[model samples]
Target: MSLITFHRIYPSAIPPMRGDKSALGSLPAAAFQYCEAIRTASSFGWYVFPPLDIELKFDGAEVFCFAEESGWNKLSSLYFEDEFWREWDRFAPDDMKGYRIPYLTTLFVPGIVQIWSGLLVSTASDYSVLVRPLANVVSHRGYQVYEGIVETDRFAPCPLFINIRLIDTSRAIEVYQRDPLFQVQAIHRSCYADGGAYAEKIGLGPPDGVTHGMSATEWDGLRSTIRSAQPLRDSQIGRYGAAVRKRAKGQENID
Candidate 1:
C-alpha cells in the first residue's frame, strides 16, 4: 500500500470543505452517493481526497496587465510579497517568459503563481501520481487544463499547480484565503507474481503445458525496428474477443 504525507506548508492553508450529512441539516442523493463511494474506496487503501489548499493571486492585475518595458520594472511589485515571486521570474525560461506576461498586456494569463511553495513526500519508491484541479472550480473558468503524470521517487515530491484559463480575461478572479485549490491521486501499478503463467492463462500463448509465455507469433511481432510501433502484447486483446465468439457459437449450437 502506498502512502502520501500532506504537510500544511503555510498556516493559512486549510483542509478542503466537505459537506456531509452530519454537518448539513439534510443530504442530497449525490452527496450520499459520494459518501458511500468514499467509504468503499477507503477500505481498499485509496485516498479519495481532501487535498491541502494553497494560495494564489493575480495582485494589481489592472496595473500589471498593462505593463510594458517602462512599466515592466513596476510589475515585480504585484505579488503578495513583492520579492517572493522574483526568483521565479529570474529562473523561468524563454518559453516560460509568457508565464510572467503581467509585463505585457495579454489575453491569456500564465504562471499567476506557484501554489505550493514547499515540498511534498510519497512513500512509494517509484510511482506515477496524478494532480487534478478541483472540478467545481475548474468549470468556473471556461477552458479546462490537465496537469501531466508526475513521477515520484525518494527525492522531492511533485507540487500541485492551478492552471486557470479564463474565457473573459477582463473579469477579475480571486482565490479566497482558504479555498481548496487541487487534489492529488496516487496511481498504483498493476503487479503479477508469475508473468509467464498469467500471459499463458490469458490465451496469448501455446497453452499451459506447451509454452510458458510469449507465443512464436507474439515474439515475431516484436521484431519491428520502429520506435513508435505498438508492442505485440497489445494485440492480446484479440484473445478475449476470440473467447466471446467461441462462446456465442456454442450458445447458438445449443439453441
Candidate 2:
C-alpha cells in the first residue's frame, strides 16, 4: 500500500490572540464543523499543522492569522524555483509583492488515493505545476461569512468556511481544456527517495527544508504584481460572481 501524507495550509493572517490557551479557542465551532464536513464528504485524511509564528496584517482585518512553520517553508521553497516563480509571478497576487499573504488559504485534495509516503516537495520546480492538478479538480462552495461573532464568550472574528471537494480529474480536464485561465499538462508516474507519488504516478525528489522563508526582495516583487493586477482580479471576480454563488449554494447537494 502507498503511504500518503496530508498537509493542511491555513491563512497566515489570523493567528490566535495573545494568551489564548487553546489553539481553537478563538475559532468558531461552526468553522471546525465545516472543516470536518469537508473531510468527511471528501473521504480524505487531514489534520491542522502545529501553529507557527508567521503573522500577517491586512489593511482592514482585525485579527492576524498565524501560519505554521512548515506551511511557510513549503510556500517559500516553491517560490524559489525559476519555473515556479515565473508562473507564480504571472498569476499569484503576492508574486511581485514584498512577502504579502495570500488573500485565500488553499487546501489540497490528493488526486491519487493509494499514494505511498510522499514528501512535501519544497524545491522542485515542477511541483508548482503539479499543484495544477489539485487546483483543477478541487471545488469550493457554501461560504457563509459571520462577522464579529463571539463563541464561548471569546471574540471570534469574521470566519468563512466554504465546502470544498475534489472532482474527478479526467472530467475536470475535459472541461478545463476550454478555459482560458487554466491548462492541463500531461501526467507522469514515477518514484523518488523522498516518497513523492501522485495519482498520475509522478515521482519527485526529496524535500529541501533549507530555504523556507521568503526574502525581502521576493516579497517586494509579489506586492508589485498584486498592485498591477488589482483591476483584472476585480473584473474576473465580478464576472464570475454568479457562478461562484451557484457553486456555494450547491455545495451541500454535491454528495
Candidate 3:
C-alpha cells in the first residue's frame, strides 16, 4: 500500500500576512478539531492546515476584474517571504511563460508532502470543511476567492502551493490562523488508466475458487458441518482430511 506524508518548513507557527487592517487572533476550537478529524480519519491521505494567517482585501472593482484589457483583472495580492516565494515558484511549468493568463502570485505554502507512486494528490476548498476567512472582515472582501488544485508529482515529495484568485472584486476575505487552507486526497494511479479486462478473464482471480477453478460438493458439505454448533471430534477431523485429499485428486484429474 502507498502512503502520503507531510512536513512543515517553518518550525513555529507564523502569523497570517494581512493586506489591510483585519485583526489576527486565534480561530475557533472547531477549526482545529475539524482538521484533526481529517488528519486521523484514514491512512490513505492527510490534511495540511495553515501554519499562519492570511488576508486579501478588494475595494470594490478597483483590484479585481474579468476584463482582459483591465489592469486589475484577476490580480493576486497575496504576499509571502521572498525566499519562500522563490522556492515554490521553482516548480511552476516552464511553458507558463507563453501563457497570457494572469500570473499566479506565489505564497509560502504552510505544508509539504511526499506524494507516493500509484497515487495523485489534488486540492479541495477549505470552505468544504467550514474552514474559511473571517466573515465580513473588511468591506469589499467578497471579491476574491481561493484558487483550487495544484500540480503534484505522483511519486515524489514536493511543496504544496496554496493559490488564490479574485472572483467578484466586491469585497475582501481573510484566512485565519489554523484554517485548512489545502486539502489533499490520494487517488489510485490506475484510476487514470483505462481498465483492460475482468480479473478472472485475464487469469488473475483466486486460484482455487469456483471461477476457473475446482468445485467439490463434498468439501462444501463438510465445511457446513464443521461450521455448525456440533463439536468436531478426531473422527470428524480425519474424515475432513480424506475429503480434502479426494478433492485435490479430483482437481488433478480435471487439470
Candidate 4:
C-alpha cells in the first residue's frame, strides 16, 4: 500500500479527508444510484482545508485579509504565524528566503494568491502528488483554485499551499477551517514509468483487431459496454451503481 504523510504544528490546521460529505449530500438520488463515475470521482482523494478561518478582500489589483488573530490590517496577503513551526524555517534553502510564508501574494500570476495548507507533505519514493480543487464540491465561490502536479517524492518538503485566482473582486471571500479548499491524490511512479516512445498508431491490427473498422469480437465488446448494462434495471432505473458495487465485492464481473 502507498503512504502519504503530513506534518504540522498547529491545532487549527484541518486534516485531510477522503471526500466532501457535503458535496455528496448535494448529489441527487439519480447520481448516487447510477452515476458510478461521478460518485467515484468525488471520493477518490483526500480533501485539504484551510488552516484557519480567514476572510480575503480583493480590489482587482491587490488582496487584503481579516482574521481575529491577525488583527485588521493586511496587504497583498495575510500571515498566520506559528512560532513553533517557524523554527523549521531556518532549514529551508537559501533560495526560499522570502517565499515561505503562511500566506502570500504570488506575483507570478495576476489575481492569484497562495494560502498555506499549514502542512508539510511527503509521499513514498515511488509516488508523487496531485494538488487540485475538490472535484464534486457544490460551491459558486468567486475564485478558482489551481491544479498542480508536484513531485513530492523528491520535493524540498516545503509546506504545501494552494493557489487561488479571484474571479470577482467586489465581494469578500471567507474560508473556514472546516471547508476544503483542495484535494491531494498520490500518483504512483509507474504512471510515468513509460518514459520512452511506447505509443504507436497500429490500432488496426493484422486480423484479430480493428483492421478496416473493427473486428467482430471488438464490435461485441463495444456494444456490451453500454448495451449489456441497460437490461439490469431496478424498477425503472438502471442498476449501474449496484452492479459496480457487486463487482467491487468480488461478486462477479458485470459482463
List, in order, the clash count of every candidate structure. 0, 29, 10, 0
* Prediction 2 global C-alpha lDDT: 0.26
- lDDT pick, better of 1 and 3: 1
- Tens-place lDDT per residue, model 4, 1-255, is 456888774556777778743454877877766777778888877888888776777778777776566654545655656563465466657775455465555555667878887787888887878888888775547788888878887884647788888778888887777778888888887776667336533344454443344567976866545633456642434556667788889989664
**Model 2: per-residue Cα lDDT over 138-188, one tens digit each:** 221211111111121122111222211223322211111111111112122
Worst-scoring 10-residue span by lDDT in model 4: 196-205
The whole-model lDDT of each prediction reads 0.39, 0.26, 0.36, 0.71
lDDT of candidate 3 over 1-255, digit per residue (tens): 233343444333332222111112233444323332222222223334444444443454333223224433434433334555455456558754232211224233321111111122322222112112233233223333343333343323444444444344444454544543333544434434358333543222345454453347645755554525455633343333344445756844321
Q: List TM-score per model, in order.
A: 0.41, 0.16, 0.34, 0.78
* C-alpha lDDT of candidate 4 relative to the true structure: 0.71
Candidate no. 2 TM-score: 0.16
lDDT: worst 10-residue window of model 2: 112-121
For candidate 4, the TM-score is: 0.78
Q: List the residue pairs that clash in candidate 3.
A: 16-53, 133-174, 140-171, 140-172, 141-171, 141-172, 142-171, 142-172, 143-169, 143-171
